[model samples]
Target: MNLSRPLLLASNSPRRKELLASLGLTFEVRVKEVSEDFPDTLKREEVAEFLASHKADAYKEDLQEEALITADTIVCLDDKILNKPASAEEAYAMLRALSGQTHEVITGVCVLMKEGKTVFHDSTTVYFKELTDAEINYYIQHYKPFDKAGAYGIQEWIGMIGIEKIEGTYFNVVGLPVQKLYENLVQLKIVV
Candidate 1:
């Protein structure tokens, strides 16, 4: 849990917090309200990183000596972004769209310090088996994945049953790409 500097995770996501803690570095949870909007001109692959950096900037003025970590996760299918669902019907539709389809889960991360900043992203391609309407409803009713991107949590029951395979790290699909983030923190001498 020793770190070169105080670490601040600028996210309210429980999954990200858990992932960061799994790295064995103690960090403080610091949440700030920031706009998640991105330009329409940005490609699907670029939005996650863009929003991550944007969130990082919002916390820059508050940075003293602490290293701030910010991240944004998005689910993309056929060049469309599936944001957090607002209603059960929307969640159902998203899960339906993802049934038997391959989709990209991209997480953009930013490590910011008063000295400098590093912005990067990790992409994982997730393959879902065809899900039955009953299965989808069951998951929605039981898990209530409205807070997750793509209306699904890879660590949840639906993921256990629906996910067939993934090309990249499973942790990336969970939320934070801890391997990459740990490396970045080490390279920056933020963590021992």
Candidate 2:
């Protein structure tokens, strides 16, 4: 483990903060504003990684002696990407569309060290039970999922009752995939 370099996490997501904290790694948050908009030509699976790399690029100059971690998570249904909902109606629509469907939650992570950079992605298949309009409305109004991709949080009230099953790392759906991040760090000799 390298103690001389500090680890900087560049994201505004509290879920990402909490998920990274769970790994017992010490880090500092350095939020950067990058335009999340990407080319429409990108397949649904590429968007997350592309945006994550974009975020990492923003911190490239600042990490000469630090490890910079940047991440992006997106929800994909039928190959279409669902990002954060902008309005209540949009949130309801996203939730309604996800009702009774299995969607892919893809999280892209980038770890930039002094001499190298690693970018990877993880996908989780989440199955949602059939939800009623009342349920969708309730979650949109109560949970206020405007900040979450797919308009819902798997760790919140909606996921507690609506998610029936999952096929990959549950923490990926939360935000940063901590296990993969830790393994990558170890592989790169950035952490023990």
Instruction: Please give the range of 10 consecutive residues that has the lowest summed lDDT in model 1.
Output: 18-27
Off by over 4 Å in 1: none
What C-alpha lDDT does candidate 2 achieve relative to the native structure? 0.89
The parts of candidate 2 lying over 4 Å away from their true place are 1-4
Q: What's the TM-score of every candidate structure?
A: 0.98, 0.96
Q: Which residue pairs clash in candidate 1? A: none
Expressed as tens digits, the lDDT of each residue in 114-142 for candidate 1 is: 99999999999999999999999999999
- By summed lDDT, the worst window of 10 consecutive residues in model 2 runs over 1-10
Model 2 vs. true fold: TM: 0.96
lDDT for each residue of candidate 2 in 1-192, tens digit (9 for 90 to 100):
344467888988898888877777788999867999999999766888899988899877777788999999999999788989999999998998999999999999998876878999999999999999988988888989999999999999999999999999999999988889989888876785
Q: Which candidate comes out best when scored by lDDT?
A: 1
